[model samples]
Target chain A: MSLSIRHSWFEATARQRLAGLLDPGSFCEFLPPAVAQPSPHLAQLDLPGAFDDGVVVGAGQLGSRQVLVAAQEGQFMGGAVGEIHGAKIVGLLRRAVAERPAAVLFLIDSGGVRLHEANAGLIAISEIMRAVLDARAAGVPVVALVGGSCGAFGGMGIVAKLCSAVVMSEEGRLALSGPEVIETVAGVEEFDAKDRALVWRVTGGKHRYLMDDCAALVDDDIAAFRRGSIELLDDWQETPDTLARLRAKQARLQGRLSAYGRCRDGLEIWAALGISEPERVPLLDCDELIALKEGLPT
Target chain B: MEKLEFKFPSQALLAAAPPALCGVVGSGNLEILVRSGVDRQICEISVNTSARGFGETWRAVLATFAASQAVGGTSIAINDMGATPAVVSLRLAQALADYRGGAQ
Candidate 1:
């Protein structure tokens, strides 16, 4: 029998996502809620305390290969990263490099940092970004999965893009600043902040896929995302020349700069990639959508 | 955080298809994205605002546009930092014009 916590991570339970990602009965959540590893900064600010500080990082396995996993909690201040939260990510990424696990999977859904902690959150996120890049230098596969409605923005979005592979769902979105924030910074006349379809067009999974930023765009189920992650790991294992492949990947990005530099909108990219009907492209069912162009890597 | 809600009925009209858009995702800025389906029938709009309490007014502006224009089946998404009403309609219209080329 399993012991249930009084609180949950979000709409889906933490262990539930873990179970899907890891082999059956293989997950042992480290620093779990019941273990009482809450955020220390909360007390300093007179803010209500939280368990686990909204991030869960630990070691697990994908089939027989070992993997490091980190999942952020969206319920807690939209899963903002604070000092401890960002530290946990850095620590695990470092450990993952040392262990040379088959891969590292980060379940991200954050607004970047915890404002209550101010500079701590910002600094921590900065460290987290460096850690992700380090994981790449070490040749460990890093996969960032967007699993919540928060859609992973700000610093988190930038970090997520640097992963060796990105697996986002139909609902996943990635942006430097969210729609409302953009309207404020750029002026309402320059941009419209009230259009949901417009926002999703630039950031949603379909858009990311069309842009070559997302490795695989799956349905809205965790099982699908997990399955995609497993396959990505398997592909890396089969080749084992991850670094060489990625360099070629970056070279492709350099090559495409001219084409995408002048172009804007997901449809343009879709059309350039040979989706003859760019206007009808977004309306296509996932199955009907054309395969992505051969060479870009995120 | 001050939240403002209003509408710009295309200052003209607009639409999305595998849609396209422009602008920055920055503090105090907004991004315009849309999929203008080839349909000349309807434009479906859903604005998730940090500024609460303008649903009816939003509906009114939308109604005004719908009554005048026959835009249909296009999907739109907007992220607002606090844009005024006129800018809203103008950006949408500009997005429509730019995308008529199926590029940025």
Candidate 2:
């Protein structure tokens, strides 16, 4: 299907992306800005505070089925989670468990916690993690869209991994620690922060998809994202075999850890995965990259 | 640690419902939250800024916003972080415009 150049999901704002993902005219925001739910912690520190605390939370319809939706504003403090923002997400997830929505979609772009309110942000993330698991346990499928510039890092990366499925765009990145942080701690030889290509190879969507860390990989278009999400929701069931899936995921994660535990670069892991020319994968587009990973005719 | 509150008369009313927000609280930036007000003819405003000794500047900016009469029946709450007067006015204008169903 052809995509419009104007509707690049990577460049769109969180609100625009949410509107595109949801069925038209079905979004209803909860605890909007007028509620004045800005973080008090920032005020105490004399820091600037956004009205919704960098998050837009609400309910929307995805193909006639009601779903809970939350999108982080990556431009706002790098979409960090503070006290109020964390509470809003945790509240929504908890409500989803009771409301039993068709699914929960988190357009995750956060770099994790707001360093200004470190303790509260950490605790709030813990609560959100618990809430995601709760919603999952209640039979609500949770899907994460990690396609923004901020991508997902720190606690949010773990949360995205915990979700039922993760859909990613080629520009999206996913990792526990950001490249700069890793470079600062692991030394320049281990991970160079200035090397853009190296950074993408380490955490970009193509690498994550090849590593089996992501479920669906698509082009940077909102239509692609919407289609991917609707397709997943259509096949969604109550997960009677959740335990088996969990075990399989755990084993896969463990296998990945062992496989790359000693590797200094992403190319080493790709080479181990039997890619004839690991260096060339980074140059391929989404479809070609996935096909190459799966050894399919491209 | 500076905080100020003011109310001004306006002719235009919100085009949509209450609770429209605009901007982010990044460095040298600000965020404005616009809510439904008690009086349809008045626009109430409350500003909290990290920069001290900017009360006159803030009042001047807000007063200019009020005279434009672009919005009414709204209470705007601002959280600022050392933003310049231009940015301050832009955020306030954006908030009012957004409350009137304009793009933010």
The model with the greatest TM-score is 2
Candidate maximizing lDDT: 2
Cα deviation at A146, candidate 1, in Å, is: 1.6
Clashing pairs in 2: none
* Candidate 2 chain B least-lDDT 10 residues: B95-104
Model 1, A1-298: lDDT tens per residue?
Answer: 1243312222453445676778875665655543444466765543434446767788887877788899886655677888878888999999877888888889988877678887988888888888988887788888988857677898898889878778887578888887778789888764576866667777888888777688887766666666778877777732244688879978888888876777656667767776667777567655455243343333
The per-model DockQ list reads 0.01, 0.59
lDDT of 2 by residue, A176-200 (tens): 9998998899898878989989988
lDDT values for all models? 0.67, 0.85
Model 2 residue A260 CA deviation in Å = 3.5
Q: Which 10 consecutive residues of model 1 chain A have the lowest summed lDDT?
A: A1-10
> How far in Å is the alpha carbon of A92 misplaced in model 1?
0.9
If you assessed candidate 1 against the hidden native complex, which CAPRI class would it receive?
A: incorrect
